[model samples]
Target: MSRDTRAVVEELLRRIAEGDHERTAELFAEQLDWRLDWPADGHPAVPWIRPRSSRADVADHFRSLSAHHVPELNGTSVARILVDGADAVVLGEIVQTVRANGAAYTSPFALHLTVEEGLIIRYHIYEDSLTVARALSA
Candidate 1:
């Protein structure tokens, strides 16, 4: 049997938690529609803060994330997940230390994903941009 939408999303999250960005990118469709609900003004200073289209963009986003922050894998937490049909919503928290200033950035996040044929076609992320920006600027 083919993987269901929830399974596909769960696997994607698993790969991300494992810091397997390449594998995560592989889970995305060739023409992905990815959006992080952060201010566009921040993009000039932060590469990962911009919009992403396609798997290569996703990989670049992860690369920028790694370049800017050191994530606390032990502190990462997942609060909840809701999956229906081809869509899934995940609520979680990420703890990261900013590479520039050594400040900690702890933010709760909500991710909305749409999966088709076991590949993620759409990804929308909601998080506290101000907290992240402050950490980066500190």
Candidate 2:
């Protein structure tokens, strides 16, 4: 990855850590496209934030998460970023605590993200799938 791509990835991680939602989305171009492979055994079909080529998609995505009131996740830590030109990878951990259905639980996870052109184009996420499933079911 070029240094520029690495810089972009670093900036993205910083923005996310700050929970700057608008700024996080702004980094992606209007013609951007993103893909994510999240563990699906437990969580609902709520969309995780991603870059899309359409502004409408961006609005819809953010609205969906907000409407669901997916509590702001905690313990998000981007460990490192590796850039390979237009493609880059980020290794990190994410922790979320959800209180719904009169129950509560937490999900801790590790992940690898692949980005392109300053936009996340793909994600190969791996984590404790069962733990996440149980938390979401709570």
Specify the highest-TM-score model's number: 1
TM-score each candidate: 0.90, 0.62
TM-score of 1: 0.90
Off by over 4 Å in 2: 37-73, 101-130
lDDT of 2 by residue, 25-63 (tens): 666666544443243222463344333445345445545
Best by lDDT: 1
Q: The CA-based lDDT of model 1 is what? A: 0.81
Each model's lDDT comes to 0.81, 0.54
Residue 7 CA displacement from its true place in model 2, Å: 1.2
Stretches of model 1 off by over 4 angstroms after superposition: 1-3, 72-74
